[model samples]
Target: MYTPPAFRDDDKDSLIATIRAARLANLVTATADGPLATPLPLFLDETEGEHGVIHGHLAKANPQWRVPAIGDGLAIFMGPDAYVTPAWYATKQETGKVVPTWNYAAVHAYGPVEFFEDADRLLEVVTRLTNLHEGARAAPWAVSDAPPDFIQSQLRGIVGLRMPVVRLEGKRKMSQNRNAADRAGVASGLAASERPSDREVAALIS
Candidate 1:
């Protein structure tokens, strides 16, 4: 989150895009006991609130929900990332002054956290989340595919969460601080990497 001016991303669309692209996110909250974090598949309900609302669920056994949060909760979403070797920097060849770095996109959303056990709301949340992830598949599944009693029992085992986003912080460190030549070198190097994630980062270098 310590984004330099050159790497700061204040564009709303860009921030939302990073969040949507992230298949999983980390939810963190400060508590009297300590800090707790859960990796979850969260979705943003863009129609709600000023910034929007985040929706997800946690296992009922997860103590994070039982412990009262002292302040706003944070949800972290990360996009494509790759390690950038100094060898990819033209400055390394020219002046040997460049060091290794990382290129990635990330978003942090902060807001009050609410956990609920309402069966109806839990059912809605699970259904929507399932559709969001399965929409792209050829044989997309649905909550209705399962028996209602079974789904209800499953819902009883988890708690739904909602966080109306009060703030959003985005960072895109894609060689923006580097000179054009160095950036081009980085793009090319990453594009040639066998790692698909590196290639994905290469596409975002501009």
Candidate 2:
């Protein structure tokens, strides 16, 4: 992630928040064959190591887990994003110097990839992940809601992943490069747009 100084977001807590908010993430790993990627719903565990750890599960048929990773796997988390038109910038009317760009927030986490098949650990990971996503529901569900034998059988078809985060990079390109007037113009334009994603970027700018 090549983040300019004005757009960089290195705050540890803020980086973790972005990851948590991005319920789904892309896991990327390189190998002798080629680059492999999987879209996964990963949870961050801040208590684990210096940076933190990530947990998730992949289907047994997914070849990503079987290949030897050449280096630390990267998890990409994306937040609200939108396309910003030059019409949204104050400079567009002044000198027409503004060009279109994208505004968004993202986090990149790097760490050694670890995969395991231990049933107990898998159960724990699944339970915690389930609770995290379901806690807000009126009727929350748990792993125990299913029969033990059925749950055990289901676990056999997937592999558990653990990545102890070694480094993190974050970026929030929310029109911070623009002047106050330009930023305000961008926010107002976005706020008036019908796209929900545009509305989200509007809130960030404001």
Candidate 3:
């Protein structure tokens, strides 16, 4: 990520918060054939290693897991994002020098990738992942709700992945480069937008 100093986020807590807020992430790896990516629901285990460990699963049929990655794999997580119109900038009226840009938050995590098929480990991963997402629901569900045989069969169709994060790059481009007046203009404009995501970004402007 090309993050300017004003937009760079090096706070470990902030980086983890961004990752946890992301409902889905893109897992990318370089291979001899080419680059392959899969959209996955990944979770970070902060207790694991120096940086942290990421856990997720991919369909067994997905060739990305079978291919040997040339180097560390990357997991991309994105937070609220919105397009900022130049019209929202106070500088636009003052000097007409402002151009449109995007405001967003993102994190890129790099680490060695490990794909596994152990049934016990797969079950543990899936169970934890399920609980993580479902715990907030009014009527939460569990893996034990299903028949053991059925769950085992389902697990057989997917492969689990583990990655211990070696590097974490976080960017929060939320009008930090703009002057206070221009940032307020952007926040006001975004807060009025119909898209909920825009309003979410507006809250981060300050």
The regions of model 1 sitting more than 4 angstroms off are none
> Which residue segments of model 2 deviate by more than 4 Å?
none
Ranking by lDDT: 3, 1, 2
Per residue, candidate 2 scores C-alpha lDDT tens digits across 9-123 of 9898889889999989999999999999999999999899899899999998999999999999999999999999999788888999978999999999999999999999999
> Once all C-alphas are superposed, what RMSD does model 1 give against the true structure?
0.6
Worst lDDT window (10 residues) for model 1? 85-94
lDDT of each: 0.97, 0.94, 0.97
The best candidate by lDDT is 3
For residue 81, model 1's alpha carbon misses the true position, in angstroms, by 0.5
Candidate 3: 10-residue stretch with minimal lDDT: 1-10
Q: Please list all clashing residue pairs in model 1, or write none if there are none.
A: none
Measured with C-alpha atoms, the lDDT of residue 148 in candidate 3 is 100
How many residue pairs of model 2 clash at the backbone? 0
